[model samples]
Target: MQAAGPGSNTARPRNAAACVQVRLDDLIAQRIAARSLVLAASRKVSAAQAGVKASRFRGRGVDYVESRGYQPGDDIRSMDWRVTARSGRPHTKVFQEERERSVLLVIDHAASMRFGTRVCFKSVQAARAAALIAWSAIRGGDRVGALGFGSGVTGEVRPAGGPRGVLHCLRALADWDTLARVERESGPAPLSQALERARRLARPGSLVVLLTDGFSSDAAAEAPLARLAGHGDVRLLLMTDALELAAPPRGRYAVALGGVRRWLEFDAAAADTQWTDAFRHRRELLLQQARRLGVAHIAVDTRDDLSRCLAPLGLALATRRSYV
Candidate 1:
């Protein structure tokens, strides 16, 4: 077969070919290297002119205030052993509530995110969005962390403050984005599993952002998402592709999976009506459920510019800094 020219529409062999990967340097350039990019994006947050509700109950505190005699309702875990021994009375350590909010980026690198026909793959776009949010969060004096799920639950990064936390989260994002391009044959970890893990990682008043294609039919995640939203802020960045919603041109096409190449006969006229309807139904159902569950849903397409696409969400986030 003749080689695919500079502009061929055929899907290339993902396994045999060196898939275009997201480089660490490039991510750094977009984030730390280009400090102004992050600063500019952050500046827009204040312009939103929205006030974030302060957290109601103190979740966790950073600085210790003072030691006092233990009250009947005081938590035993907060006992000051030394003070109790010295004073011959039970004493409890008092800590001031931490002002910093924790932001967790639950990024999905499932196989579905690996394909894109426009600007970049969904996986890469997800990474960019995560990076932008991480920077914004850290700049706002909030802690940043991540729970990544690719072929399976890849890993989690505990929340931390300042540049260190943002760097750690971005590193994990880049790593997972590269791994997704490898084309693993194993089934992807259910989106529900990731949500469950997020439920555990997030504390009350925390901000949780879920980045995915939003094509899953798994209803199991509904409860967890609602639970998380109940105690913390939950936002969804639904990654989508223009082609996914509709059939491609009616013609024969070469589809590549792993190292094998196969021919797929694409005829919109002969396409199964039920399958098309199912796709539309699933998409609508996912959005409807997200709204019903009281989570902010933003549709992010592969063609979208990361910074521009995320600007409006920044405003929503501005009002979400503090949660009950």
Candidate 2:
């Protein structure tokens, strides 16, 4: 009576539940109350641009500000041909810079995030950093939205410009991990889906804060990232694990699937160049791209308190008058 019972079907429920976003709204709210540094927690914004917003970075919207007589040293490119035709004088029309903007955060949650050494996993650090940014954005009077990505799931929240909306997003991001365990069986949604959705939803001149491990294998993770380059102002913060960059010393392991031998390796030093080089090199280039995109490049270790990273991002927007 040795009938092979049910052929290990455990993966069914897990896979089926992959995309369901379980709301950890309550837990996230509590964490925000405890861990958040925002002073006026209950404050709401009145003017459309009251709270912290990204448009400030846009630096005054483009407009026909004024005309100046063309100087001999003026580049030909600055010459206002239309103005020249309008008036019988060589003049250069000055255009106002874009000042208003929204910031959209696209967060990644691949299974790889679960692996970390210091304080938490990459996912935990990512969520924490994201929540801070969201709160700061709300304070800046900038609209904010989020897209959570990983093993085929995308959790979305519409952009909100006031305190209430910011609170809502903070709660969602804070409890994201618990929610993922309950609602998602697969890992996070795919990167492509999250970025694609952000691209479509974000307005022109918006700032996109992409929080990821830069773990994409698709040709240097550049092609997928390039997809967002044209959308608006982009900022990339690569959330990394200590082990991925600087592993522990001298461990030997073999990967196995039943009888199939996958990989076997042994290293004397924890920080083996051969093994960790890929992540290191990627980090450098990740920052380089951010530089090129005029985006902020941040490297965060999941093991440390996220505040180390978040505090600076907050500082970048901490100016009181700047908020106005």
Candidate 3:
């Protein structure tokens, strides 16, 4: 049996083996290069806040705009007690609508993402995608934060503005990516739990980006995604590998994981059509659920360029649906 397999059209160059490891230096370089790229839909953030586009809804901001007599349906929680007493009538504080939105990245650095036959690992691609989005968010004057999780480790960063926020999120991404491979304690699916955590971190008028390999695309993931999308613009960027979509020709291939090497017996008897179909079905279901719950979904093959794949869809996610 031949040890080498035919490369897919989407696969990277012949020297792709050199790019296997996830490097912080490479991630930093990608961020620096992203400075020249512009995200068009992110520019409509002010319009989204104004309700002109069905994107993010306006929420109470830090800057006070005005105070006025409370209307019948006005939220009681927003009532200004001191102003009400001073005016001898019920009053409410109105805040300026926040146009600068928050960008939240929910990245999964699971062990399954560590295996890649071509180009780079899914984790590396995810990191590259995150860097691109982080820099874009910062350039658009939005706050950036992240929830990085894998195996038994999780890191959370609160939303903040400017280069500082972007840098912090990138550091967390690098740290988690580096540690994911060493973590052997696996429990209840990490993606589902990560999504639940993401739902809690999301604030109204925020953009939440989920980066995963569709490992937990089951019932456990749907509810939390719906909840997250209810309050924020949720975009699911799924990472895939060509090997999962199609089986290699008949062969007994050697594969290694967690320092253990094993041979996968494949022959005419092992028609992988069913296995490939199941993988395709799972991906389809995730995409369908995203549509049903109003979450934007984009699929990226590990062999593809992260920046090019996400630029167009990122714009659509910014304006296509309402985050209310």
Q: Could you say which candidate leads in TM-score?
A: 3
Which candidate would rank higher by lDDT, 2 or 3?
3
The local lDDT score (0 to 100) that residue 147 gets in candidate 3 is 94
Between prediction 1 and prediction 3, the one with superior lDDT is 3
Candidate 2's C-alpha lDDT? 0.57
Candidate 1 residue-wise lDDT, 112-165, digit = tens: 777666555667667777777777777767788999886654789999988888
Better candidate number, 1 or 2, judged by lDDT:
1
Q: Which parts of model 1 have CA positions greater than 4 angstroms off?
A: 1-19, 32-97, 183-185, 258-260, 270-285
lDDT score for residue 118 of model 1: 58
Whole-model lDDT values for every prediction: 0.69, 0.57, 0.71
Query: Which residue pairs clash within candidate 3?
Result: none
Which window of 10 residues has the lowest lDDT sum in candidate 1?
Answer: 41-50
Q: Write the per-residue lDDT of candidate 2 for residues 1-324, one digit (tens) a residue.
A: 011112221111122122122233422433343344442222222332322454434343344667789876665766888879898899975665433446688877666665555444566557656666665566555777877766544677777666677666666564565555445444335455566678777776566788888664233345545666665556677887656776546766565654797754556554477668867674566565556555666777654444445555554433322222
